[model samples]
Target chain A: MTRATKPMSLTVNDRQVGPVAVPEGLMMQDFLHEYLNLTGARMGCGQGICHACTVVVEEEDGTLAEMRTCIVGAHWFEGRRVRTIEGIAERDTDGAVTDLSPVQQAFIEHFSFQCGYCTPGFVIGATVLLDRLQREPVSREDLEEVITEALDKHICRCTGYIRYLEAVRDVALKTPGLVTS
Target chain B: MKKRFVVFYTAGVVLIFMFAAAVAVFFGAFQSSVVGSEVEEPLLPDERKALAERGAYVATAADCYACHTAPGGAPWAGGLPIETPFGIIYATNISPDKEHGIGEWTRAEFHRAMRDGVGKHGAPLYPAMPYVSYRKMTPEDVDAVYAYLMSREPMPVADKTNELTFPFNMRRLLRFWNLLNLPGDTFQARDDRSEQWNRGHYVVDALGHCGECHTPRNVMMGMKESAYLQGAVLEGMEAPDVTREGLLRMGFDAPSLAHFMQRGVSAQGGMTGDMFEVVHFSTQYMRQEDLDAMAAYLFDVDDIAAAEEPPPQPEPVEVSAEIAASARGTYLNLCSGCHGASGEGIPHVAVPMTTNITLRLEDPRNFLQTVLHGIPELDFPGVERMQPMPDFADKLDDQELADLATWMRARWGGQGSDVSPSDVENLRREAHD
Candidate 1:
């Protein structure tokens, strides 16, 4: 918990980048989330009130992880790597890139977004969440709460929460063992 | 010694303050001698006649009875649910009960509610109540509506439950919303305008909220104030914009819109849905000059687009062959006797199926209902069909009447549809009464 960390070059989504300065006490949330990038991760509130900055971070050991880029530091990846949604194949399993991930597909089918502001962050967070939950499954009540909390992680001013929950429910119901009886 | 002195001084000061406050309030309450004194008489003989006359116009403008009374529920007894994006709002009892209605409302309090979107206790009303429109009424007109309501024979109805979620149940934001929406000023007579035009403008814009339905709203849900009279949709009924430009697109001129308003005929088409009902209950009752003034004001409006009307198509007259002869035979034998052969209609009244916009409409539910169950009260003198349109709902199956209607439409190149008995049955079941 107490150690001095040094900055080093790292690969982000396969792009050579970053010997970027990160504050010693700064959260990972503060680094990849700097300057004009706020435009990418949205300042839905710096207190992590929204997950518009969610990104996937890989550890130095080749193990990759999902992270809210705002609360994590850019320097945490001193010699590590990361992948972002922008890194996904323009296609899916069969070279059909329009092949949206299950979450994106479900979102469209449910008419989940009206203004579509919080969707990108939500989509990324959900992508990582689905991967994490593959090792486990949940019950009905647990499913609704986890899905709600996952999305409640962000703020949406329109379409309310019903359609968002519906989109998640669609994914959970179909993702095989994501929701066990 | 110090405690005794303080107690004596506080008592003397408190009594003087209370008396002064009471005296100031007593005088302030009667600050407007005109308002204070006239209401004392309530309705003098001449005043009663004047008020009743104005009340009729106010009633038409308000369309108060529409939401309150419903199809045949007690007039103005309330209990209708108004839908909003936020939640459903139930209409409150308007019937005079000391505990329920405005029996407790002072005239100023009533005016505030009408013009300010605030109740006497300072709670804001749900916007569905149309205070935005009422805010435009001249004070005197508001007074007239108040007079009309006060004149009604009071009925007692219990309070109904309202269900809205939190933050929305919080009425404070309404005040904030109103600050953004309601125009706080009262209507002042325009020195440059004609008396009739000024009066009509005041009545329609503010008290009538004609624009609330006609004008489109903006991002914040506020009316795009500058583009005042552009058309907007209401409960799926598209109220054509009464503005000059809007009229051109809708294919009407001042004369046409005016003529249509008087009769149920839209120059482009016939009124349907809520507008159709309004044609009978509200506008048809208006004086010719008032109708003329409304048309004039809308036509004379500055931004009218000069446009050509689309060419007319021959009217529709679809009927089923199976029942065509029998239906026509039925109409000639049974209906023509009361309806007249030409369908130009009997003099003074009786809706003509041949050319009457109401009868020639694609769906003849209201016409069919009036014909079947009969209209309430509205009887004509010379025309025999005046008493009731008589329901032959049982006699004709769906297609037989459809064929007859088809025959009528084709009779003079009129547009009509095949009436189905099921449409009749559905209408009967749906009719509130």
Candidate 2:
């Protein structure tokens, strides 16, 4: 009945991670940090109040949902396609960073992070927002609310949340398919 | 024709040179006169006394004694160890002790050290002293601080050597760090801002140096100006964001913030950790008007460009029968006495669990930590002697602690996530460490 005897499997950052046995009580944050070496998903508050340990989980309909990895059990992510902060930026065959995604670029241009401990969660959350906007575009008037709705779940203790909002706003506005005129 | 053209060109060049020379001479004289007129004369006895008194006020505003003095140590006889990522740096003794402190330092030397981050022997000071913020202080204020320190009963406390490692130990290298991060501009009253706002800005941004802790730092340890007071983690505790949105999230208004600053408690909860120290040593002693000004400025200044509607509230979570049963048992045994069976805390005695935001927050670390460590009595004026919560770390196992926390949150908060034994264990280990 112990967590150690439970079988767990999940897709992480577009890769099939495991049908590997994990402790039943193992947190997704531990699986990512210790097992997968995805340290980008930081553990700011183990209790999930600060979304510094957030990741994007793609649902059955291909809609991305943000989830706090810290509080949730690793087994909860079974059969789910989870995207981390590491998956946002493009890399070449040599694994060198070739280009940053629009959200990543926006974060850099706006200086949207300081210590960047909470950045991965913010990036992933913002990415999910951008994806949601592209799928169902909103009017310019409603854009702020949409962005707030998407990102307010994630906490960025460094950049007063203003810069991140502005960055996301910039990306949403600049990208042709995101917003209806 | 060629000779006439040459003569005209030479004549024109000579006239331009003369004009440039006159302009330079005029500016040079103006600058010298300005500098000369601003020079301080030797202080008379009454002037010295007045300046010293002003210096005492400046010292309070600057919170010089907080970092400089060790716990239970003589004022300004610094031996307080400041923890940084690189290493521990000890504050130097600023008392006017002939052998141990700044007694031999001349006024000019003191000013240079304050404004330029240079020591008496021309060595660079570590930014831990916050000379970058102090540099923004007025020359008059600096002089007053010097006079005040000089007038104090000199404590012969020797300065402790810093425990910095490797390259950081090289004091000379701090000069380079200074070049990149130091805010060289002196404090200037912004014309567009109200006088009260400007005063608040000066106190918060310059003299009080709240940003030194509240503002997040870059990899190189420079304050990220773009973020401003967005908030930052200091020694494990999140220095909660002070922005309008952040304040709103925390349920703070101007009055509440001012009250918290002055009395270390608000509707949210009482101050703890570094904030308790801040109130005890610094903010509590500030004038009520100044605290109000700070609150007003904080509430209004740096309004996030985007319109911030509070996040949509999540649907209430339901506790299962089995979990609820165990939680009830744990709660009845431990928490229900103080925080009633209905979680209706006794008014003016115990903090009501229903109104407490700590349980409602997304992270239950604070709640867990509080349960494990207990709340020490913070004797504030006007408020009753709030009874301290006893530490339950030894009495309760992880599962019991988790159950108790879960029960409190589920019954009172109505919308919080579940707490696990692992969560309780992690927090317990952290607290122990």
Candidate 3:
């Protein structure tokens, strides 16, 4: 059977990536791995039940939400802005690693991940949570619940999830204006 | 003075007559419909085995275990709280424990309870027990079920107290309810109908008790006989009309309906909401022939006399440009990824929006609720499965959700775009409650 193809383009990591031909129903996970050669986002379960393959998508109104890459097709992200794990860290003029993002640093400091397969998804989730909190800060009392609501979906097999929770909580507390009185 | 005396006398007489009539009705409802002895002779090993096996089948068809067993609790040691309009009624333990469960209850008592909604101690049971539907079960079936219950492992769990409100808290009030709602006769085979049809009727009405949820109830909370299987909304979910005309209109034939019953998902759509429990616990375990019979009865195929044909699809209508433009992007970004760009639906992932009956519903409560709180990943019989639909409750605001629903309904559901932002808000609030 002849495969159907569609032309699409999207902004990835602040770069104009494609206006090229892609299979009609190719998943975003495959496109990230095979087409763009970006392997930071690890595919887990592939059914969207496990949110381990999520990437950040910026809405038209400049709000952020995580979309599962394994289940969503690449064409669905047409003309959209997205951020993967590889794009999270700071880069210098020579394109060398400058500094780790606060979420990444927190994860390392707290020993949040063991296998690191699920770390990318957790980082994305935490980043989105932090971004959301920036706009609408939570009270210290409701901080834990709010954090759980955001990062609860991302599964980590090796870590018991306590460290990850603590890491995210530490970032939320340390980052002023993210958690209010 | 003489005229006043005459009026007072007349009023007193009328009051007495009314009281007498009420007493007669109460006695009439309480009268035992089934006559049988609880005493039984000891059965041989072979006979006991056969009886137990038959009992198991009847119990499954009746779906006794689903209600009797609480989540993560011992089987038949009931603590499941059933929600009704009145209040929550916790299911009674039905294990073989003598003190707490129904171990000492006679077969005659079980028969009376099943047929009349009366407990072994002659107390009236709440209608949440579905005795109104179980009253239609044949004596043999009831006996088989009783045997099956006796065979279950007893867990010495005590019954939970019901938490009904005001006048409904009084069990004596149900005598009047029974007077209006209770049917006297057991299942009767229609001579004009085929055996399969009769069997199907028994399963649907008596054992399966589908009407408890599907059939609309009158003000008295009794199933309305005139509008049987017309569907009703309970706990914010609309059970769609399953009448012959309604089924056909929604694109269902016997084969597909039977297939859906046997294995939760079909080309039409997979079961969601309360129906998932029915499939997970009841219909999935039923025999294929019974499933076929149920489909045949629901579609009323015998009267058609024509060859079985697929139901015709609805003609596509154009959605308003404004709705299309507003919600199309949201749908593409969030939903279209799994549901398909054209709403064709990904096989084993999401159902095709075009034929999904939820959108075709007159009451958009179920549709709106599903969208606000997305469905969890579900497993159907065999290899059939669907991934969890991400909830848009936190992501999309009320207006966005309403627009998306309206767009979906108009574009593919053949429904009008009448879902206002307020409708989404109200349903979202109600879902939380």
Candidate 4:
């Protein structure tokens, strides 16, 4: 019942982090922002309704799913491999961002975000969708449905929803492996 | 001797007439010059264009588009419904459509509407128009607004009638309301204050109309000037006090308040609810100087001491095992997902239940209303994502709502009394009506 007793550990980005003692009810969002300083995982709606706090988690089977970090406790991520927004870019030897992820680039080219607070979640969600599609490609006609299903939960109060959707669609179309012609 | 006297009297009469004529000529020349300057000359084409542009800026300051434009409707076409305790009053079309909007309204007519809350035909307009505040606008500002509105592309949307109950259905009754509340005149720059302070006062009191929401209303639903900016509930959300004492509680100073107005984020948290929309539509678009001035004025307001001592604490409700179990069940089923099991809300995300002052208010009406209707998503600049709370009205009955509220108050609101089922029902009916 006490806070200090909970066992927590996870592989964040690529590195293994903590068999650290996370207090009971410590949100994964706080664990990332406060302890790790990975602010890319934003705390949007602690309620999981706005998926702005979404991070990509690799399942035991090596498949990815978007998880809401704000609602879940840090202890819940024990032994999990999670990818945050900070891990999305391709870094050079000096850790300088060499190239942006296709989704991130697409978001930029289309001017998909205004404040960028919601961008991290959108990137994670889109990344998961792209990963899923490469394994199981959908027809071009079903692309809209797939994008909606993936990114609909993330709320972007600015730039409307159209630009974000279009950006996602552009990536899906251009990334040859995602859609069947 | 008689002929000589007659000749002298005639000469004197002629001299008197000549003096009177000279005085009349002088007065006529002075009157014409004064009258010429008083009457505004017709604007040149370039001047008209410039004035129209300025009018657009003034319109933004006045926040005309926010209330007039419905969600996804044409800008200023005016179908937005304003919810009130008495009824829903829809905003009228101010677009320049001759048939459906204000295109046919003369300049004087428009000025009268803004200054007197009277329509083109002398019909009394509802105070929902905020004419009470608009009346403080200068004639030049009013004319500029008219010019801007006239220049806009007219949307031919017909105005929707207001839905009100019995006595409120009478628009004529607003004349009486106006008589009681309206301070009929334009803004006068205070001689004692600095220019910046006076400008700030004008922006807050006239254009921004901050008191319309922040000031508590009386029994007649008129704003309580004495308690200005001390806080009040608006449309089921608490508009926090912006007065000195209230700002002090929030730990805000002039610079921070200025920053909040400009960016919609402050040290406290992101602006949410109606204030979010206000920042997005109005203050964020304002000049930095104006925002700083408003902040300066706000900071200068003398702190009103707490009027009365805090109300005596109610006896704590002792929870039996069965009652606790029931309340816990309700809370877990409905609230635990967002509020968290321990009510430790994720910072900068969902507001923590533990620190939520709404649950501990003297009147529980807002809490009940929020539960029934849910909080809507507000768009704040820089703060990207917002989630709307889903209404439990359709899902939960009165008793269930009471149980949930009571549980929340007991667990989070330390000294709060239990909310009864009847209390829930009364609030629900008030909300519905």
Candidate maximizing TM-score: 3
Q: lDDT (0-100) at residue B160 of candidate 3?
A: 91
RMSD list, candidates in order: 26.7, 22.7, 4.5, 16.8
Error of 2 at B431 (Å): 4.2
Location of the lowest summed lDDT over 10 successive residues in candidate 3 chain B: B35-44
Give per-residue CA lDDT, model 1, range B1-433, as digits (tens): 9999999999989999887755554333212111223333344546545676686578676777666654655656778777765677778766555677776776677776777666768677777778877776666776777767766767687656778888787776665566567665656767776766675676567645677677877765677778788766554334556676656444466666666766754324345455655656666676766666676667664212222343243454555566665665456434543454444444433444544433433445545554455443242212221323335665456565656655665554355545666765666566543
* TM-score (chain B only), all candidates: 0.60, 0.79, 0.93, 0.71
- DockQ of the candidate models in sequence: 0.00, 0.01, 0.26, 0.10
lDDT of candidates 1 onward, in order: 0.60, 0.75, 0.82, 0.76
What stretches of model 3 exceed 4 Å from their correct place? A1-39, A42-47, A56-65, A69-83, A106-115, A128-152, A155-181, B1-4, B20-32, B35-49, B303-307
Residue-pair clashes per prediction, in order, are 15, 4, 0, 0
Q: What 10-residue stretch in candidate 4 chain A is worst by lDDT?
A: A1-10
User: What are the per-residue Cα lDDT tens digits for candidate 3 across B1-433?
Assistant: 9999999999999999899877765555446455455423434446545677788988888888788899898899999999887889999899878998998887778887888888888878888899988888877777777777788888889989998899999787788888778876667889888777777788889988989888999999999989899999888888889988777766777777878887889777889877887888889999988887787777775432332776666665576777666677567656766777677888877888878877776677887888778888888888988877877787678888788888877766677646889998888888778
Highest DockQ, which number? 3
TM-score (C-alpha) between model 4 and the true structure: 0.58
Which is the better candidate, 1 or 4, if ranked by TM-score?
4
Residue ranges of candidate 4 with Cα displaced over 4 Å? A1-23, A26-181, B1-45, B301-377, B387-433
Q: Residue B208 deviation, candidate 4, in Å? A: 0.6
How much is B72 displaced in model 1, in angstroms?
Answer: 2.8
What is the C-alpha lDDT profile of model 3 across A105-181, one tens digit per residue?
99999988888989999999999999999999999999889888888888888954889899999999999999888
- Rank ordering of all candidates by DockQ, starting from the highest: 3, 4, 2, 1
Q: Using alpha carbons, what is the TM-score of model 2?
A: 0.58
At residue B367, give the lDDT of candidate 2. Answer: 79
Candidate 4 DockQ, CA atoms: 0.10
